[model samples]
Target chain A: MKQKNKKVNYSKWGYIFILPFFLTFFIFSFIPLVDTIRYSFFQYFRSGLKWIGPNFVGLENYKSLLQSDMLRYAGNTFILWIIGFVPQIVISLLLASWFVDARLKIKGQQFFKVVIYMPNLIMASAFAMLFFALFSLKGPINSILISWGVITETTPIDFMGTALGTRSLVGVMNFLMWFGNTTIMLMAAIMGISPDIFEASEIDGCNSFQRFFRITLPLIRPILAYTLITSIIGGLQMFDVPQILTNGAGSPNRTSYTLIMFLNDHLKSKNYGMAGALSVYLFVVSGILCYITYKITNDDDPDGSKAAARKRKKMERRMK
Target chain B: MESKGYNRFRVIFAHVLLIILSFLCLFFFYILIVNATRPHAEIQKGFSILPGGYLVTNFKNMISDGTYPIVSGVINSIIVAGCSAALCTYFSALTAYGLYAYDFKLKKVAFTFIMAILVMPTQVTAMGFLRLITKMNMDDTLFPLIIPSIASPAVFYFMYSYLQSSLPLSLVEAARIDGSREFRTFNQIVLPIMKPAMAVQAIFTFVGSWNNYFVPALVLETKSKMTVPVIIALLRGADYMNRDMGKMYMMIATAILPIIVVYLFLSKYIIAGVALGGVKG
Candidate 1:
């Protein structure tokens, strides 16, 4: 009885330890998300100083959002994401590989790393303002174009006034901010590969390309998967940059309008149900993306996963 | 060791590529610094190639002007960010300690529950969170900002793994044998072991909170209570304020300096082992 009591005390500490996280998460995150799910079914209306009810309105919010250009805004987000993410993946992958190359003799590698990640630490709103200024009419970019004879001073390109220009600016910002993070994560993954493996590959007369494809790529698949999924998630939720850039109007033909912007618009109009529905859609889409990432990345460990499963089963059997 | 001529060229080419990449990383920073020092008129005249002498004026104007309240914004940001970081690190580490050290009935359930929500973008929960905060009278207050960070699943996972990889049960046992209470064991023995992780995650949380705009934009309503990002947005959004381009640049430059300074001092520790447990969800 005393031993059991001691064990009970042991488990009590576990609960005590995790209580704060669960409590805070429940109050702030879980309840809110559950409430969002519930709110998706009801319409919100304000009543003077007191905000009124989430009266049940069934699937109307989802139907209305589907009937509108909300999907178009999603498309805009996808376009921005693609343009931004592709270069981000490619460039960061190259940098990651380069940084790890002992033969490269890259000087001040630490400085490059520190500088690259500096952007990530700064606020996105600050980036938006900085880019807005840089790309504004008669901004430095215009001056550079003029000097380079890319366009005459009289014909300085209006970057913010055009969809492609603004999208590209957004894309550039995403690339700049994220490329470093991806590089760091990927570099860590590459370095995690045992040096003996590299020595073994070299002993087999494997060329650099062979080493990358046969060893590095296979080894870093997990981090690659992680970065890809997170990048997609961040891209899908691209809000502050475009919103601030176009002053939240999604100007230049609403090209900057994203799902978050659309959702915010609904929220502004007190269309709480619609905002909830949009958030649910985002939630579902993210879940699906995560599933796909798991599928692809898990497949990379074809043998190891199965072997681990077997080991786990064996351990379970032994315990039983 | 002597290398072939072609291999030597490859090395040189790699250096050149690195230099180019580094330039790409540093380009905007250079532009921002130059723009911040230049006069408003010079900035408006299509960018001065060189730095002007208006940085002090721009800063002075920002300080004197109460409309933007750049100074208060910085203080509010520091408070919110600092509190969030402290709360996030300490509570997350505690939570991680719980999950890591114990074998409880709900351990797997708790783990899965938190991990499932880890990837759920905060935006999905924003509407409901704002409503709750408003109902609780936390809107326009920093409480919502600082409190939610306690449930940081990313920090939790990082610390959990850090503890798992480094901590030994025997250490805890030894402490218990030494007559230390459970809390004291954690505070004295476990905490010291988790210090490196706490520091790393503390910085991450700080930077994340400092730069976070979405939730703060929604929750923080008042002018004095606003964070740096919120203020920057308002100032940039105001059309007339646009004329003080140098001040705007200076504001941004100033906002990023503290973080850059922290990073410069801690870069060696930060970049190493940050992703040692990289495969986390």
Candidate 2:
């Protein structure tokens, strides 16, 4: 009996420890997510001061969302994401490779990292406000451009007033905010490669360009894929920057309007059904995009488990 | 091997590129700081790279402005962000320690369950969350903002990895032999050992909750209840009368000041934390 008492199974402790996290997650996130899906099927909304039906509407909300400007908002999201991401990934890769290159012997790498990452710490809302103030007709950018004679005072560029200008600013802001983070992550990925591998590749007469493309890029593919998937999900949820920058209007013909902004518009109007459907659409679209990115990045790996399995199957077939 | 000349050229080229990028990173912030010190008329006149004398004046104007509750906004932001960060780090660590310290029948399922939702964006559940909060009468209050941080999947993932590398099962076994209760062992022994990871994650969680705009904007309709970001949005969205750029810049500067100060002190840990999270993520 003493021995049995001494041999306590500690597994229940694990459950007890993790209970609060699971309980909170289920209550706060998972249940709401499931409910969001349920709400999408109902015709719940408010008309003026009157609460309307949560009556079963089946797919009516989804049908209406599809017929509306949902696709355009999605396109805006994708375009904004692509523009920001291209520059971000490119610059990050360049900076990451350089910083990680021991031969470069870069000084003050920490300072550079800290400085670059500072923008990311600022609130997106505040960042948007800063950009708005700076790009206003009377703001600093125009003032400088005027002083430089790039544009006359009378014709100062209306940056937030045009679709291209607004999109470009949003893109630029996103790039600035994220590139540092991407750089840091990529640097860590690069550093995880053994020095012996690089030495061996050097012995094989691989140039820097060749080494990066043939070794570093392929080795870091998993992290890259992870980065891309997260970025896509984050992009799909893009809101505060564009929302605040455009004054919640998505103005200039609503070309800069994002899916979340559209959802926000519906929510503001107390249209729960439409908002729920839009949320579902966002979830589905991000899921598909993440799946595609994962497949594309993983399937082509020469040394991956899937490839190995394929090779093993071929070998078995030959033996048979 | 690459020639000495080629290596020198590459080094110089890399330095030049890094310098230019670093300059670009700091330029806007520099502009923001410089503009924050000047009065509205001065800011509207033109951009200045130099500091001005009206910093105190602008700050006073922003804090004392009757239309916007900037002071309450700051306090509300602190309350929400502070509570969220503490709960997020503590609960995430507890969850990670559970998976780390013990074996259970559903251990693998539990680990995978948390990880599978790692990429789930909060936006996807906004409507539902809003509905939940409203139904619970949680809107216009900070409860919803602070309470849901208990299950941050990303933080839990980081903590789990940190524990795997830093902690040994022998420590727990030794504690059990010494008659330390499981919960007490975690609190007294494990928590202290996890101080570094907790600090790093706490800073990140704090900043994240501080900058969170969407959920708060959706939930908090009352001016006094709004966080700093929400208040900044309101200030920006206000009519032309309140669109004082200097005061706005001051407010924005004040909003970002805490994060900037924290970053200045703990940037080394924060960068390392990102790198750590990134590798396993």
Candidate 3:
């Protein structure tokens, strides 16, 4: 804590307070992040007890990384997000707007909130495994599809076998898992918007949709940007869904293999150099996205920080 | 202008749409629970809408299966999740209080560094970190799982934001004026005030650690040492248990019960949190 009256430097306490976090981060997170970059440059092999080499390969690993399916894997991951988050955002926004609209007396709001958000509480891998069994050829889904004459009993469709099938299944899971959280977040944003804005828009003869697009959307842009960027970053780290759904195979010709899955494959196969390169690739891509998010959201912050600085300034002004 | 009848129709339509969506949201869980109670052969006969009488049988089978060691998996999960949640929350809050309460030169840089780590994909650092753990001979131990969570950027960010909104610096200054030690003040005074934030973060961290299969799958070599998700994976692969799909569904249900219970007990706080919203923001 600070004292306005005490002028001598007491920042040592600040350093002490924050030491555990930094020390732990230094050992576990920062070092590994640096190691990922460092390990990317060297070629290595397993040889008995002693490792054969982490000899300087320079950009050799990077060069070969370009030739891999990583770019495609990244694309597939984006496609999955597009499929998943589009419906997610649309539904969440709609639900949120309705709840925010007072005229729409949506009863049982609390119940629906709990029910919808329930799925997010469980492990993604557990859900994936549940779906894996549920969609098996002899399982309930295929049996029903056959009964409904959607497909023949003779050749049951392999839901996890084809690329599109696998992607769609994962997409559906993602959509289901996320939409509620998105709804809650959007609702929160709407709640934060002053009620007067909505009333003014209504008085100006703006319809519900117009008010939503012109007023609510514009004001909540920061939140929207935050969600989108985080989702993009999270989409890149999609591992548990595809990994478990395909039983670690990344099947259907690895179409469901995300960037993490691809790197995990490298990790599993002990191709340390190649895995390191992929890790760096992922880090760079995510860093760029984070930077873009930072720039977009902090455009108005003269200090080049976010709202925290502004809030602190306000606090300081209040104290004065 | 639209007629009153048309407005009524529109409102009704929206309600129906939401109702259907909620049902769809809950449908999978319904099936999973139902399937858990159905006999393995009955499960093969395609989807049935209601519960069957096989839950006890499935539970017994799970317990009796010498190969799976599911009880140990549950215990292991509780230990890992519980420890990680406590360490992550207390230390994160302590660190956040550090930044929030104090004035320091490198404060901004430290804050930025934490934010960077927030978005920095764990997959990027996972390999090197794993190697370090193995080198330290910490592989296959819960220490590796529980220890690193103290540096959780996401949790730190949450605590930082919570402290920003809730904790007034005047209180800290008052405590200091009374000659309360810095760490003691944090532990006794600030921590009690941070209960709601801690509870929310604790549930999140606990569920996340409990559900985490990736790192555990990598480090744990022995079956006895594995968590529930990994053991579920084992059961799925075991050809003998393949016939016991009911057991599989039952196991999944059992694994998630603690999470569901926590959710039920603390969902009001969580909904409040949902409204407050998000580590990234």
Candidate 4:
């Protein structure tokens, strides 16, 4: 009885240990999240020194946002993410396969890995600034291009002036910043696969492309899915790079504008109602994306899925 | 014989591609560094592959300029990131240990809750967080930025998995038999065992906090309280365009130098940690 009592005492220590985390999380994160939702349904803003209404409204904030450029900004985000992610995934897969190919005996593997990943260490804001300096009207890139006669000194390319140019610059920067990390992750995933499987595939006369598509690609699907989901969430919250690059103006006609930048503008204007509504929108969208990815990627058990399908069919028959 | 030749050709092709890609990766950084050393007039003239002699001059110019509080920004960034790394690692470990060490009534519930919130992006809660900070009068302070480190779900997840693999419950039982207190056992025994995990997570958390711009930009109104990223943003403002280009580049260089230095020393661990984190997830 005493021994059991001591064990129970230890259980209370579990609560004690976790108490600080929960307390802080509840006060700082949980309450704020709830309050955000509360504010979303209200009319709240500050006009100069005077306080505006905290008056309750329906989904009026969300309704107005739909009428705004929110959908266009969302489209811009999707386009930017796609442009960056396509090249990123392709290059990462190529690099990972090459690095992991034991037969290749790639020299200085460690050196290559270290060099590639250095960009991920640097601050994104600093990175944006570097790009901004490099791609300015008389920036190094333009001057160099002119000197090399790639383009005449008469017409320097305005890299940040057009919609396509800005989006492409943004995409290229995202690709550079992330490809290294993605390559490293993919290499790890490929390495986790058993060597015997590769040996068997080679013995069966599988070419490099065949082996990758049939064996490596399918095996690493989970990691790929994980990467995609995280990248989607990250892309949705993309503000720092474009924000710094365009100096918060979203440039050339607001073509480079993003959803978070819009939300930030609302917050900057002290329009809490709109900002709160946007936050709730982002929350719901990300939650749905997370659920979809989780469901899609978690189909690791064929028999379990088959059983589920059978159960659904049985229910359908009974209903009939 | 044909296939053997084909394989050799493939190997050579792959090496060539890799070399080019690696060069592309480092080329912009090379340009940034080289330009940082050049005079503003020389920079305006054109790009140069060679390093210039004005590195110290650029540094001096950046310091003498009174536009932004560069010194205070660096100091504030260090304090916030350092405190965040420490609090995040210690509290995450403690939280993970609690879940791992005991089987209580709400154990599964708590575990699931943390995991569910793991994917909850901070951006989604920014509006509410801002409102909360204002109402609590914690605006313009480092407390909002640092205090939220206590409840980092991703770090908690990583630590929990690390404990599962590295720590044994039998050791806890043995320590208990020796009459060591619960907290002491955790601090003395578990923490040391978790040193590698903590170190890796510390680097990541520190870099994340340092690179963070959004939260700091919102919360910190005082120039003295602003972080490196925020200051760098201010330096990139339209008014600074007519300013000295060399100094601007130098400031940008300074902003990223600490992280670059840290990465150079700990590249192996940071790279390994990233792979490990992804795999575990």
Instruction: Encode model 4's per-residue lDDT on B244-281: one tens digit a residue.
Output: 88888888888888798889999999999988977754
**Candidate 2: Cα lDDT at A212:** 86
The alpha-carbon lDDT assigned to residue B228 of candidate 3 equals 89
Q: For every model shown, what is its TM-score relative to the native structure? A: 0.93, 0.95, 0.92, 0.95
Q: Worst 10-residue stretch by lDDT in candidate 2 chain A?
A: A293-302
The interface RMSD values of the models, given in order, are 2.7, 2.5, 2.2, 2.0
- What's the iRMSD of model 4? 2.0
Give the DockQ-based CAPRI class for model 3: medium
lDDT of 1 by residue, A1-320 (tens): 22464643577888999999999988998888998899999887564567667689899888988999988999999998898899888878878887887877677888888877777777888888888888888778889888889999788889999899889998988888888888888988898789999888778887777887888998887678778887888888899899888899888999889888887777656667878998899889988876665455435454388779889999999999
- Model 3 residue runs over 4 Å out of place are A1-9, A47-52, A146-152, A296-320, B1-3, B236-241, B278-281
Residues B14-115 of candidate 3: C-alpha lDDT, one tens digit per residue: 889889988887777788899889889888777888799998998999888778888889999999999999999999998999888888889999987777
Residue lDDT tens for model 4, A146-180: 98889998799999999999999999889988999
Model 4 - which docking category? Answer: medium
Task: Report the lDDT tens digits of candidate 3 across residue range A180-285.
Answer: 8888888888788888987887778877667879998887777888889888888988888888888766678877778888887778766778888988988888
Model 1: residues >4 Å from true position, as ranges?
Answer: A1-8, A46-53, A290-320, B1-3, B240-242, B277-281
Top-scoring candidate (DockQ): 2
Q: Which stretches of model 2 miss by more than 4 angstroms?
A: A1-7, A288-302, A305-314, A317-320, B239-243
Alpha carbon lDDT at B165, candidate 2: 91
Please give, as one word, the docking class of candidate 1: medium
| Candidate 1: chain B TM-score against the reference chain B | 0.94
User: For residues B159-242, could you state the per-residue lDDT of candidate 1 as single tens digits?
Assistant: 888888899988987888889988998998999999999988888889999999888888777898989999888977795335
